[model samples]
Target: MNSSYANKSIAVLGAGESGEAAARLLHQEKAMVTILDTAEENKLRKKIDALGAEGIRVIADLAAEHESLHGHYDYVILSPGIDPAVPLVQHFIKRRIEMIGELELAFEMCKCPIIGITGTNGKTTTTQLVEKMLNACGVKTVASGNIGPAFSAKVNESSHLDVMTLEVSSFQLESIRRFHCQTSVWLGFAADHLDRYRSMDEYYVAKIRIFENQTEDDWAIVNYRDKLPALKAKKITFSAYVPDGDFSLREGVIHFRGERVLAMSETNLRGSHNAENLMATLGVGFVRGLSFAQMLPPLREYKPLPHRCEILRTVNGAEWVNDSKGTNPDSVEKALHSETRPVVLIAGGKDKGFEYDLLTDLVAARCRSVVVMGEMADRIEAIWKSRLPVANAGRSLEKAVELAHAAAQPGDVVLFSPGTSSFDMFKNYADRGNQFRALVQALPS
Candidate 1:
């Protein structure tokens, strides 16, 4: 247990997974901890009761008791969901209380080296790949942060782990103070979280913070295609479209600085995006003293995670793909380009302030028809209607799947890749994708 936290008062500003984990960790460290959430009491009754059983204070309606919290805490642990611009955060900020994220708090207690992966997309896939590869090569590792479990939840097991493969997000990086990864892999960057960020630049600034504290001993694995800022760590680059980086795709083979690492045919992972993910995974493995031969077994046996261009079934010759993880325009664009057959695309979800017109030309050329759904359906339809046959499914994902099925020819592919978030009509992207899969599976052959 950390002696410094024993007498300090810490307020965790969220009751979600990460927030609860952070509060629990602080309590274990003998800190005076209070967890606060703006959610109604009834909604979080079980969680609140559970935490209270352990003698931890949980404020269910934080907004209602906001004023009472003044001058109480020495530190505030911000959950990824809590916006810094909110009044509660600003209040703590103005008072000069030290604020940190669950990621930072966990980092302070972790004894193992961390391999951090961050980007607009593919962070989850790359994090999983690196974890699996490390474990296969006899390294004790756990996938944490934005992917498996909250960093705080897994920090106690650091002594048992040789490495922690973390999926770092821009939100988690925002409140980090001294958190630094041994190796940081930036998959790629694209415009995302516009609703939370003031601009694309703001989002980029948050992501680049992953490497902010790294020194010459650390490594920064980046995409050769992205125009990123300079970093102090030693850099390694990867590219799927070209053979110019340290790891690159030349013809159909993956190469590491002119040596052939692996061939695409040997792996189950498809799409150029997956190739990029593979290269980044290789870069991480290579830096950790792992050889391509040592990591090949896991790489070949690895199955793609559900909801990222996963094929559900081929019904009556038309392929149904569930890319529910494609929650941004850039991800959807990659999915569209990866398909060979004419696509009957089902897209649109909660608006993140992304411009749909940017995909106008690509949709016109690749899709046989477009089925739009959720909050941004009409807005997306307005952008693509002139370019292709666009059908509005309103807020129903079931209707969207049916429309896309009807529009699909025997040889065509029906792709459900919502180019924005899934908060409008679903719990999350996984919920949205699962519903799409169920709807597709129930269809008559």
Candidate 2:
């Protein structure tokens, strides 16, 4: 426990999952905590009530009457979703008050050596894979950060002796001071989350911050495809497209430093992108002194997580796949590239302002039809209409499935790979994927 935080007056902004977890951890350490969330009380009432019962102040809104409380805060922990550019957060900057993200606080309290993973895509799958390989080799492991329980919640719940494989995001990395990882993995990167970043360079900078505090003893996993800078840690490059690396997946078998590690056919995963994820995780497994046999058991048993090309039961001889997690052009492109069957793609959602022209060529050749929905439905339809039969399903997932089913025939796939965020009609991508599965399962054969 940090004695410095024991009696400090900490103010937590945003009562989201990470925010509430941070507040709870701080409160447990005997800090005088206050939570401020713009969301309505009922939405987060249970968390609010729990904290209020613990004698921590819970304010739904920072009204004028309670505005004075902001200045008295010794430290402000902002959630990942809360933009630092906001006036309220800037106020603390001007006053020289300490402003750090929830992950920053998690770093302060978490004593375990972290295996951190970050990139534009495949962070979740790679993180899950790494955790599996570690545990399969008899190493204690826990996965967190943007995947399951927030880092702070995991910190409060688990012992620090366990190795933590964290799926870090640019938002969480933006405000770190001394958050360091023992081993870092940077998967392939492409244009993503432009809606939150000012420029591509700015986004790239936040992604590279994962390597900021590494030491000579630490391991840095890099992608040979993605250009990166010289770093202090011992760097190990992994790739699926090229063999000039410490680890490379070629001809179904993954080679580590010219030695066989694992075979792609041995695992349940497919696609070139998945091969990249496996190669990256294999690089980390090598550093841990793991063997092909040890990692193979877990890799063989592991299945793709929900919402990323998850195939439902065939109805009427046509396949239905839920890939609602493909919220960017690159991810959706990979999904399209990996599939062999002709697709009736259900695309569009809250657009991140990424260009879709690059994906048009792939869709033109691979997708038989397109069903659009949510915020970017019209824009996506306009861009795709000349290439394929595009139908507008509005913001309804059920309608989207209906249109996709109508367009598909036996041996064709109805792939719900929304190439944007899910904020328009669903709570999140997971909810969108689940709803899509439910609606598609109801479709008749």
Off by over 4 Å in 2: 1-3, 156-162
Writing each residue's lDDT as its tens digit, candidate 1 over 250-316 gives 7778999999988888988888899999999999988888888999899988998999999999988
Per-residue CA lDDT of model 2 for 299-370, tens digit only, reads 778999989889887988788888899999888888887789998899999978888888998999999999
Count residue pairs with overlapping backbones in model 2.
Answer: 0
Tell me each candidate's TM-score: 0.97, 0.95
TM-score for predicted model 2 compared with the true structure: 0.95
Clashing pairs in 1: none
Best by TM-score: 1
Where in model 1 is the C-alpha error above 4 Å? 1-3, 64-68
Query: How many residue pairs of model 1 clash at the backbone?
Result: 0
The lDDT of each candidate is: 0.90, 0.85
Cα RMSDs, all models: 1.5, 1.9
